[model samples]
Target: MKEYKLSGWPELPASYQRTAYQRMLHQMSQGFVPLGQLLRVSGLGRDAVRRFLAYLQASGVLVEREHAQTPRTLLVMDWIRRTLGGTGPRRQA
Candidate 1:
């Protein structure tokens, strides 16, 4: 199975309202997601999930992964650093 990651946050048309599919896409935007997980989370069947993913791919909202780090991973790393008091780099006043 080809892995997919969000190229960026998807921008919906003004007419679009929050839906299960949109929620699925939002979860996906946080990280790379698998088809089965997406289907389960969206509460949609296989066919519907496939169709939506295809549409997102065609519209450039989703892109094929190429050794990309997921946003979730980055968030966790940041949390770890804070917990450890790493505090990144210090700024001179």
Candidate 2:
């Protein structure tokens, strides 16, 4: 299975209105994520997340682990985890 991470936030097109995509954007923004976990975390089903992943890849924000050459990014991700207390997916009332 391939793993991926965001190089940076991708700009959403005007047509993107799915809340699932929004949730996914937040999750992917966190750190490196494997495709399986991305689907699991988003709770938005496999097909939808896969499509979104493709879009992000095309938009150049999605970086495959093979291309993620920065160790500093890992360090920053760790800092974010510690500081944010693992703020994973959630829902609001």
Candidate 3:
């Protein structure tokens, strides 16, 4: 089972104007996501997700993550924090 992560904002080709790809990229921008989830959330089939991922990789916009070692709870917490704009800790003088 291979996995990919969003290295950063993708420089999409102007010709590749697809909403499904856009949605997948948006979700990936949030954090690392499995290919399965990408397919489910993007509402795209397995082949579509796989092809899109390959395209992103070939474009050098996708980087590999160290597998899905991240705990589900942590992922949820991170999502919540992002949703509420709270990313833990604060620096002050």
Candidate 4:
């Protein structure tokens, strides 16, 4: 999945005044946001997000990048979790 970070904040136009759009901008401003999570947050199709990101890119506000090490760490943690049966301390029984 793609990721985005808001390097610069730009006000959205009148036509783009939807809650989903607002939510996206809020999330983007927080830090690096993954496309999958954004999709869930917006509840819209990928095409719509693509267009939004494109607009941000054109406006010189969006940076398309990934947190390389974080995902790797998450993968290892998930594997360990699954291998250990579940989260936290396991039952003896």
- Candidate 3 lDDT by residue in tens digits, 1-93: 466678877777764568877888888887777777788777888987887788888878897675644598677777788669967654458
* Preferred candidate (TM-score higher): 3 or 4: 4
lDDT of each: 0.73, 0.75, 0.76, 0.84
TM-score of 2: 0.59
Clashes of each: 0, 0, 0, 0
Worst 10 residues of 4 by lDDT: 82-91
Task: Output the number of the lDDT-best candidate.
Answer: 4
Question: Which segments of model 4 are wrong by more than 4 Å?
Answer: 71-93
In the order shown, what is each candidate's alpha-carbon RMSD? 9.9, 12.3, 10.2, 4.9
Worst 10 residues of 2 by lDDT: 83-92
Q: Give the per-residue lDDT of model 2 (tens digit) for 69-88.
A: 36998777777876689564
At residue 65, give the lDDT of candidate 4: 81
Report the C-alpha displacement of residue 18, candidate 2, in angstroms.
2.9
Task: Show where candidate 3 strays beyond 4 Å.
Answer: 69-93
Best candidate, TM-score: 4
TM-scores of all candidate predictions against the true structure = 0.58, 0.59, 0.62, 0.71
Mind sharing the TM-score for model 4?
Answer: 0.71
- Report the C-alpha displacement of residue 75, candidate 1, in angstroms: 27
Q: Which model is ahead, 3 or 4, in terms of lDDT?
A: 4
